[model samples]
Target: MKKLELTAQAEDLMKSHSLQGFPNEICGFFYGKTVEGVKHVTVIKPVVNAKEGDQRRRFAIDPLDYMKAEQFVIAEGLEFLGIYHTHPLHPAIPSEHDLKQALPSFSYIILSVQPEKVVDITSWTLNDDRAFEQEEIISNRNVNTSANKAS
Candidate 1:
């Protein structure tokens, strides 16, 4: 299992978005640098959920958003680590929909939000067997300065 290093500021930003979008899933992108084999998520870039169905149980992001994130990260000298989304009433576990949509080399961070509060956060990565493997989340209070500086 790999480690998902989430900065304190990033955590707060995600939780806030989750709370604001209560009863519906909120999704976004994250960028960072890998240090010591850990996926350090630095910036939480919020974007509109472009799913075509009910958002309470489903969340989707457009491919263009990924390109934008990649470009921003490259311009800022960081890697496109992965993306994040909120599960309003579910655990911080990936669903079948998520597993099916997931790709390689990206960390998927899921936040469990109950009512208007964020209850938990977990990260996952697809393994060789195509199974979702839960990755340990490290709440990093002091990530690199670039993360702090990025909006």
Candidate 2:
């Protein structure tokens, strides 16, 4: 199975973001480097949930936000590892909409968020057959000293 190394700081920030956006889904980008087949998340860039109407059930990152995130990742010399989003009041399992929107070569980190806290977190990746497969999340306390960029 593929692995993702999440720093403690990143996890904390994700939790905070989820709570702040509780009742609505939040979206963001994960920036890091992939070494030895493991993706190490060093930075998380939160973006506005640009979806129209029912934000409680969906999230859409604006094209401009994507472009800016890409620019930031390039400037920081990091890979655009994947996307992170909250599933308000739901489990971390991907929905059919999520599966349809997933892309190959990118990880999807889903946070199950309640009104007051995050209930769960899970990482997923797309397989060759275009199906979602769970990835192992290895929590690393030591943040990446070399990559200090965060937003």
Candidate 3:
């Protein structure tokens, strides 16, 4: 399976956001450009954030911000590479509900906050059967480095 390279800051942000979204799901996207030699897989996110949602954690992007994000990515030469979400009281694995809603081309990242003490994050690549195939995350903490560039 392919591995994902995430920045340490990105990982911590994801954990904190997941913990904060404690009873519901929290979602967002990743943005970055490809580092040479990484090819299509090199695209990564320097930043990640939670989208607005109700108390239940059901969220949809702010229409204006969504459009702006698309525009920003295009203008900045970044890719809308993956989608991330937190499972407040669940495991760091995709649920049946998640599989049903997942889009094939995008990577599905799940952050589980069941422990209440810390958040556990995992990535999955879905197949035709809607099963989540486990993947890896390589966390980068250095700035001004090409470690997690998106393609």
Listed in order, each prediction's TM-score against the native is: 0.91, 0.94, 0.72
- C-alpha displacement of 2 in model 2, angstroms? 0.4
Cα deviation of 69 in candidate 1 (Å)? 1.1
Clashing residue pairs in candidate 3 (N, C-alpha, C atoms within 3 angstroms): 32-150, 33-150, 33-151, 34-150, 34-151, 43-150, 43-151, 44-150
Question: Measured by TM-score, how close is model 2 to the native structure?
Answer: 0.94
CA displacement after TM-score superposition, residue 15 of candidate 2 (Å): 0.6
Clashes of each: 0, 0, 8
lDDT of 1 at 70: 81
Q: Score candidate 3 by lDDT.
A: 0.62
- Per-residue lDDT tens digits for candidate 2, residues 1-151, read 9999999888888889888888999988888999999999988877889999999999998998899878977897989999999999999999999999999999999999988989899999999999999999999997752323333
CA-lDDT, candidates in order: 0.84, 0.90, 0.62
Q: Give the best candidate by lDDT.
A: 2
